[model samples]
Target: MIELTLIGIGTGNPDHITMQAARAMNAANLILIPRKGEAKSDLVDLRRDICAQVLAATVRIVEFDMPVRDAGGDYAQGVQAWHDAIAAVWREEIARHLPAGGKLALLVWGDPSLYDSTLRIAERLPGVKVSVVAGITSIQALTAAHAIPLNPLAGSVVITTGRRLRAHGWPPGADTVVVMLDGGCAFEALDPAGVSIWWGAYLGMEHQALESGPLARMAPLIAGRRARLRARHGWIMDVYLMRKEPSNG
Candidate 1:
């Protein structure tokens, strides 16, 4: 059986990797690094850089081209199909490299458990004896970068995606809503009256951009900056936290 370990390597900065993640990376007999063909660059460079810094020189490293997801059709169906394609690739790589059945690892961006599909993909690999090593998440990175608390005193935090936020609007009973995977900056549609926002782009990276304060005041700035950053870098990953003013409630 293949002993599979999914190691979380934090967001972007290599230093965000934890000691546990480092040890997991070093212990793996084989590591898979996925390259996204459509992205501006290999977004998984975190895996390669971490391996260079943490993995033993003799440890085997293999790079594979990741399959692009079909953006057409139903969103759920498209994602499930994409996962199947990814699992097929993973099976092929592991079989070709570790036909003897040994410890294998794949470096995950941020914590695999948070808004990530690595765990779900691992589920498709039957009898692989999967294991996980947690690392810092983009939420943590965003909060840390903004130097702010993620929630109000004795309040609940709801983490969601841009699509959901756009479709459903503000969720009831949520003290703070942290939105991720928001390429369209869905906050634009929100009633910006008493809501406050803290937005950060490329968190934990050298060119990190941050904007905060009243949603009305910061919304346009965040949108402009996001466009500029994406134009400059060809790709961007960002997250934001929004909450209604306590006084307004």
Candidate 2:
């Protein structure tokens, strides 16, 4: 049986890795890191840096090209196909590295339970014993970086992706919304008059940038900043939170 450990390493910060994640990395016989191409080289670099800091010299590190989902295809279908392709790649790499089953680890960005698909891909490996080591999530970093609570006192928050927020509109009864995986500034689609936004890019990193204000005033600034950062870095990962005016309470 293959012992598959999915360790969340947080956004791009090495220190965000938990002790559990470090232990898992040190214990793994093989650790697979996916190359997201030159546009997102920082992601792979972060993975490599984590391995360098946490893994023992005896542990083998492998890099594999990640499959990109086709934007022209149905969104769900494209994602499913991409996941299958990734699973095949994982199986091939695992077989090549460890003909006999052994402990393996994959470093995940942010918590697997959030928006990441590492856990889903692991399920495709039948009989694989899956273990998860949670780390600081982007949501946590975004909220903490902004020095704001996730929700109003005695209230609740809804966590979602940029696509859902843009396509389905704000969820009914949601007073606070945390948006992630947004390649575009989906906040532009919302009615900004009464909304407040807290946005952060490269959270927890040295180059981190944060901006928050009334959505009407901050939307354009966040949009411009995001574009500029993406141009400078070749790619970017960001998240934001929106809340109704506190006076509405």
Candidate 3:
């Protein structure tokens, strides 16, 4: 039987790694890192840095080329094909490195339970036992960076992606929403009135950037800042939390 561990290391912060995650990393017979090309090379570097900081020098680390999804095709079909390619790569790598079947681990950027699809991909593997080691998510990092709670007193919060927010608008019955994977700053389309926005880029990293104010006021500022940061670093990961005034009955 093969044991597969998906360890979440959090948003590019070495210190974000929990003791349990560290143990999982060391316990694994092998670790795999995905190389995401030149633009996002820093992401692979961060994983390497985390391993170097915690893993014993004797631990094995391997790098593999990540599959790129074809963006020109239908979105849903493109994603399905991409996931299939990734699973094929994983199967090949595991067979080459752990032919006898032993424990293997992959360090994930954020907690697997969130919007991430690593857990889904792992399901493609046959007869493999999977375990997850939770780590900080960008939502937690953003809220902590801004010193705010995710939800109002006894209130609920909605979590959605930029695409969904653009297509569906504000979620029903949601007073607070945390938006992730927003490439085009979808908040600009929103009615900013009565909405306060707190935004952060590169959360928990050395070059983190944050902006907050009335959505109307900070929308453009954030868009511009986000562009500049992306130009400088060649990549950016950001998330924002917006809360509208609660209705008074």
Candidate 4:
């Protein structure tokens, strides 16, 4: 049986890796790193850097090209098909490297339990014993970067994606909303009059940028800055939180 450990490396910061994740990385017989093309080659490079920093053992490290998702079909079908293709790649890599059951690890960007789907892909691997090592999330990094609490006064915070926010507007009963995987900056579609937003791009990195204030005042600034940052880096990862004051309700 292949012992598959999904280790959360936390926002590409080597310091964010938990001791448990470090131990798992050291113990793995083989580690798979996915290369996400030239535009995001830095992502794979960061994983390599993290391994060089934390790994003490001479474990086998292999890099594979990440498959691009087919955008022609319905969204859900396309995503499912994409996931299947990724799983096939994983299987092929394991067969080529291991050939026999052994310990393997994949360094995840953040806690697998969050919005990530690594666990779902792992489920497709037969006779594999799956384990997870948690690490800091981007939301935590975003909040800590801005020195703000996730929720105010014990208010409920709804964590959703940019698509959901743009399609449905603010969720009901949510006092604060954290948006992730938002390449489009969906906040522009909101009313933004009474909402306060704290936005962070490339959180926990040296080139990190942050902006906050009333959404009405900060929306354009955030949009402009986000565009410029993406243009400069060729890729960007960002998250934002919007809070509606009680007075505005």
Task: Score candidate 2 by TM-score against the native.
Answer: 0.97
The model with the greater lDDT, 1 or 3, is 3
- List CA RMSD, all candidates: 1.3, 1.2, 0.9, 0.9
Better model by TM-score: candidate 2 vs candidate 4 = 4
lDDT tens readout by residue for model 2, 1-249? 899999999988888988888888999999999998899998888888888887765899999999888888598998889999999999999899988999999888889999899999888999789999998899999989988999898877999999999999888888899999998889999988789999999998889999999999999989999999999999999999999865644
Task: Highest lDDT: give the candidate number.
Answer: 3
lDDT of 1 by residue, 1-249 (tens): 999998887778889988888887778889888888655474766566777787664679999988899999899999999999999999999889999999898888888899999999999999899999998989999889888999899999999999999999999889899999998989999999989999998888778888999999999999999999998888999999998888733
CA-lDDT, candidates in order: 0.88, 0.90, 0.93, 0.93
TM-score of each: 0.96, 0.97, 0.98, 0.98
* Model 2: lowest-lDDT 10 consecutive positions: 240-249
lDDT of 3 at 8: 90
lDDT of 3 by residue, 83-173 (tens): 9999999999999999999999999988999989899999999899999999999999999999999999988899999999998899999
**Pairs that collide, model 2:** none
**39-83, model 4: which lDDT tens digit per residue?**
998898899999999999999999999989887969888888889
The ten-residue window of minimal lDDT in model 1 covers: 37-46
lDDT of 4 at 178: 99
